[model samples]
Target chain A: MASSIRDELLKVLIEHQPHFLSGEEISRRVGCSRAAIWKHIEELRHEGYEIEAKPRNGYRLVYRPDRVAPEELAPHLQTKRFGRHIRYEYSTPSTQTLAHQWAREGAPEGAVVIAEEQVQGKGRMGRTWHSPPQTGVWMSLILRPPISLAEASQLTLLASVGVQQGIKRVTGLPIQIKWPNDLLIHGKKVCGILTELRGEQDQIHYMIIGIGINVNTTSEHWPEELKKIATSLAIESGGHLHRATLIAAILKELEEVYQEYLNSGFRVIKSKWEQAAGMLGKTITARTPQGLITGVAERLNESGALLIRTDQGVIPVYSADIDWKEI
Target chain B: MASSIRDELLKVLIEHQPHFLSGEEISRRVGCSRAAIWKHIEELRHEGYEIEAKPRNGYRLVYRPDRVAPEELAPHLQTKRFGRHIRYEYSTPSTQTLAHQWAREGAPEGAVVIAEEQVQGKGRMGRTWHSPPQTGVWMSLILRPPISLAEASQLTLLASVGVQQGIKRVTGLPIQIKWPNDLLIHGKKVCGILTELRGEQDQIHYMIIGIGINVNTTSEHWPEELKKIATSLAIESGGHLHRATLIAAILKELEEVYQEYLNSGFRVIKSKWEQAAGMLGKTITARTPQGLITGVAERLNESGALLIRTDQGVIPVYSADIDWKEI
Candidate 1:
């Protein structure tokens, strides 16, 4: 496959880092023709990777971009097929849109769509997501789960847990998950998960889980509009972050979590999410389309719907915009 | 809109009753050009209606084919927009598949996809539906309801009720809705409803409800395999039934039930469904992926999940294949 060749070429480039490797040497090392090596080098350059080639000295690794490439990131990722089938776009309207289209066209499960920037990214409640170029992880994962639409919400919770674990593993940052789908770092939003599904009656054709993580962004990276509430992993960790490594970790963790979810149901992931949840046992105001409901965030039910202990009763909040009061 | 022309033409044709008007006459009556009339008539022909045209006698009605078409049935339809926006296909793999595609491409609410035949029609549990040409109603409706996926099952129940009402209205035959999503006549399945949804997190994007009804099919018309279990409207009514009229009634009833469901919760519709449900208070065996659940079919919950009162407990069945026992 072209991807395998690309991966092999990337490995040789990383191994011979900071050195100029002659085209003949690269061909011999990678077991390919010199012309093939040249073609791959040109392709890498087109993918926004920086490589310098001299007439006699051959190719030099000038700079490796932070964008996620299967070749550049495959060595770090441990998942079997979750991130194996990926569509990397420099710019897209929304990863979710592309993922949805791919799923409808019979793209395999675990296929991913990642973008350097999203011109029309979306969050929950039809809100616009701010995805600056090369600043955040704007990706969507395609899943074909044999579950009812009611039970599909469990995937959102599973993704939240995976994201929390991935952030912790990659950057050693202490992150917490807000009940529902927000991932928070030091009490500010760092990531959000949006799960979409296509199904008929009992059969789920496919599902697209879109995740947006503010990885390498700073307060200045965000518009003045979102600086107050939004936070990035780089800002929270006080350093520059590797987007490729983080993406690989996230996909690896998601594969494991998704496997556990399918095998054992949501009980295991639900407990993990509850432990990482920041707003459990806290009073919150939720704005639903019907009306506003004030209640204590109790816990997630077996089907992954949020159970809110309200004055009226234990209302199962299918969807709502929750605002937690500072305690 | 072009749909308005199709609707007006349908009204005139239905009023004429087994008679055909020339293209010039229809164009003059509809205040459009003869070319426009020819175009609309061609559109109707594509939807599976058989129209006969001559040089001197002009156009004569050869046969009103058994199919679902806006032009052939729209005059009889009373819905506002449910059946107004229709995509009629001669053959599709499945209406649900096409409806999902249309929904993703920004198809309006109440839009419909009707096919003369489904090459690969499907039922619950991967069962193949028998959709013979012009002998059944294989249609899918696009609905943009403001409800969670958990509540989407309610649409199936509402659709069952609608189908039951529609059949009764047109054929004056008493039909019973089998607990989850089937319409039965004399304990034989005459219709099935499959409800699907597209959503992100808690917000639902669109819901596609596919309905298959055996219309104008006699015992000889059915395959030998389905002769004992499936009965058509014609077989039940002891005469050939007009497919377009029945489709119009179904769409009208579906529109009404959908509107009522949106305005109100599933409480009222659930009660009506319970009254017409054949398996209510009867011993039944339901086969689910988890295991077999045997109990007396008690009622339907708010979310339209079937409530079965077993000796062990009252279990809520999201989806299952049911078999009723003899009283």
Candidate 2:
């Protein structure tokens, strides 16, 4: 509640920047006492804001810090459901684990777990995901869809499209979805998605979609082995990006797409995914448990199984690791 | 370990009943001192076993309590997977809850959690399952099958056939499977099965199959509300039945059928299920979520969905509650 008051005070200060506003005016606007307004200004100054106060002049704002605090981002959210109840952390093991724990305890749908950094971030199939502090958008979204288990892969595809469109809208950079769960820019990976579900037989209980995006990470921040394979927005665009703005944009797109999918069906999402897919019609090799199958990537079936046309037949690949050397 | 030793001592006394076996001879056979044997016998007597002790005659077993202990059940398990590790509880809230928790913690396949009674036993669709003390087989079996999520209902059918055959072999009574997950004897439900799974997209982590069998529960043991719809083996067979023997028989049958299904697919299991089905070829009314689907229950498809031939078309029912007036 105190933080909300500070936000109200900050909003007032930003509106009257470069000019002095009286303490009496601020107290009246924020419904607080003049002494309370002075205390709030002191707290705001401690939070890396430059506020000048004189005997005659009341207060004037100069600068603000670059942070993704909730009080800073809550006012920017445009979605109806997603990120309404956000669990923000500075550092944690994995947001996916926390999302699963929260969903088990009957957390409301669209609850999000976001972290500035992950100490032990997990990717698909027990792989490690690189998540450094304050340079990426690392978060997990909780959903309790009424769809069956077979449609889970399609939901993952839908989320990938949402992330791709979000980054393109914010940065004006061309983004491409690489088949199932990755987003690429100029042939380098920028985002990875992992979708998990908990259910009983034919019905689903809840789903946790963990998304990790490389936002402002530079080449120096990447590990030696990953420097050639991974690239961030700042590295490709030659400019640093604000993390909170991009996060809010992505959440808005995701929530809109999710609601649309629930209302109608997956047709709209399927079309958007196919339009952004980088693997369609490409000659690729999918490494499955059976063996390597080199074929031309066809369209995704209704159940989101990738249909690969090989020499034998059109094989529906439910899960595999795809490689496109020409791309 | 002490309880196991007492079981062994009880076994020794039962094997040497009506004959005078001195304490020295019993100690030599069990690899324990005379004082230890005496202590074990005293403990066994406290566990509702009447043992006669004399100066020269070591001990004679008069009676044994009707309880399903691990020692009594483990020797009869003839399977490679099912019931290899048993977690026996004298009383618990529900074995299904415990089984799901253990599965989440990476419990091994074929782990069984059994309770003599349940305070909060649950049925499908949020119904109550009455489980009185030491009169029913309340257990949950953990299975990590290689099949997909859609085949879960078929696995439940396979288990029902296994239980039906096992009861027939033990008591020579006619048992019929009620379509998907119930076993009935004399038109009354004697067993209820609930199948739940934990999975992601196209992969499964583990499944818990909770089975509640009315083994030795008499008519007087059931609540008034349940007496009309529930029956037990003891009440039907006109004699007291041993729960350990029935449980061991069911496990062996289940393990064999499950292995066969994995190797040769669901054909054999489906045929067996159809042979024992009570609703097949009968006009039944199914209370589905959509509405009441009244039709002739034709047969089970390969995925275990029941095909009901209605006037409109043959609709495949994944889950529903059925009502049949006569077989």
Candidate 3:
């Protein structure tokens, strides 16, 4: 909450850039004390903002920070509802846990929970997601779509396309969706998404979509186990990318695709997802809960389960770890 | 929780029935003070238990209460897990709400939430269920089933059969399931079951099966709107029924069916449910969310959705209100 107030103060300082604004005047503009303005200025400087300060001439903003603070991201967020209720945290265990609680407490659709770092980040099947501080876009979106529980898997597929397109639009990165919800660049994972739903009988109450992206994280920052299998935007693109811009782009893409899905149905989103799916027409081995099964990746049905054609016939794989070593 | 402690004192008094037991003896057995034991005896008397107190001869139990207290129910509850961790409430808004929270907090499977009365009882599709004080079995069972989200509807059907057999065994009244989750006796609704699920993309975290039975409620106990459609075991059988015994019997039936459903599959439960389904091979008017659809109720599919053979095709109806007036 204090961070949000500081962000508002920073915004006021940025709006009065190139002209020196007095501490009292900036405090009046942002509705805080002069001491608060001074403190926020120091915090902004720590956040990489360059401010020109004089003894009596007040402060003048020289440069803005590249962080994904609320003041920086809210203006660029194009969605009508998505990302409107943003809960920004510098560090947290998991946004999915908070978002689930919010959904139970009747948080409106499109509320977002984003964090700079995660202490106990989780992936699907109880796996760990390495989230370094201030280097990735770790976020979760709370959705209350009026879809059946049977069709919830499609939303995971839909979110992959959203992230894929958002990255393509911002960084021109050639990202491919790995079957269900993992995004890959140059055959290594760059992002992962986990979708969870709460429902009654056949009706879905709400869903939480948690997306973790390795944005500006360096290879050396990765743990020894994750260094080989995971790649970041900085590693793949040969440069660092703006996290705020990428987050805004992804939320916009999700809102648009979601609106289309609600209006015209899942046919359009399914086609878009299939086009970006990487494992189609390839022979892969799926490590399912039952056992390992090798089959050709045929297509994704309407419910978003992968159709794998093996010697025993066509089997629908709802969930499995795919081994694409032959590729 | 206080009610449970008082119930423990009541159990101790009942165990020493016909013998005058001192307050000190009861307190030592229940691990409370003698004054607390006296207060619990007064509370139990207020709950309709008959007790006789003498100046120096101590106290003797004269009669047992007709209520479904924990002590009364636990002795009759024979299941291994179901009703083992019972949360008994004298009055609550709804057991379903409490059971949902308990499930979210990692409550074990088969943990039961039973209430004597509901101030704001809910039925299927946002309807109000009339739950009179101390006259009905209002309870919710928390189940952590190993099943897909698509198969959640089957648990509702399975619950219907449990309620059906339990009512049959206790009341000897011929009860039949009304297509999905409602149980009807003598062409009037006697019980209603609502099933809610929490899940991931394809995995079920837990499910809550809430059942409201008009066990001993009299005709005069119902509100004006429900008097015409609702009937109770007491009214139909011309005698009051024991709610604790009925509750234990239903939980035991649910445990057995659920165990079979998890092991041998839904085949046995489906057959049992079909045998007790009242609308089979009969044309029924269903008020579905999409619209009204009249058709002959065929067999239930593996997911427990009613497969109705309409004029167009065989459509699976997951949830709806069925009218059997034509039959």
Q: Which pairs clash in model 3?
A: none
Q: How high is each candidate's TM-score?
A: 0.84, 0.84, 0.82
List candidate 3 stretches off by more than 4 Å. Answer: A1-47, A50-63, B1-47, B50-63, B284-289, B294-296, B299-304
Q: Show pairs that collide, candidate 1.
A: A201-B195
| Top-down DockQ ranking | 1, 2, 3
Please give, for every candidate in the order listed, the TM-score of chain B alone compared with the true chain B.
Answer: 0.87, 0.92, 0.87
Write the candidate numbers in order of decreasing lDDT.
3, 1, 2
Model 3 docking tier (incorrect/acceptable/medium/high): acceptable
Q: Candidate 2, which segments miss by more than 4 Å at Cα?
A: A1-3, A9-29, A49-66, A147-158, A172-174, A178-180, A265-275, A289-304, A307-316, B1-4, B7-30, B50-62, B145-180, B261-277, B280-326
* lDDT (10s digit) by residue, model 2, range B1-327: 234655566667766866767889888877788999989888777888787888866677777677777766765667887887788899999998999999989888888998889999978755789999999899999998865444455677777878888888898887899867789988899999877777654456788888999988988887788899889988889998888888999898888888888788678999999999988999999976557999999998766778999999998776678999795
Q: Candidates' DockQ values?
A: 0.47, 0.32, 0.31
- Candidate 1 lDDT, B235-298, residue by residue in tens: 8888877777888898888888878877887887898899888898889999877789999888
- Model 2, A160-199: lDDT tens digits are 9888888898999888888677898888999999887776
TM-score (0 to 1) for chain B of model 2:
0.92
lDDT of the structure predicted as candidate 2: 0.82
Q: Fill in the DockQ of model 1.
A: 0.47
- Residue range A244-279, candidate 1, lDDT tens digits: 889999999999999998899878999999998888
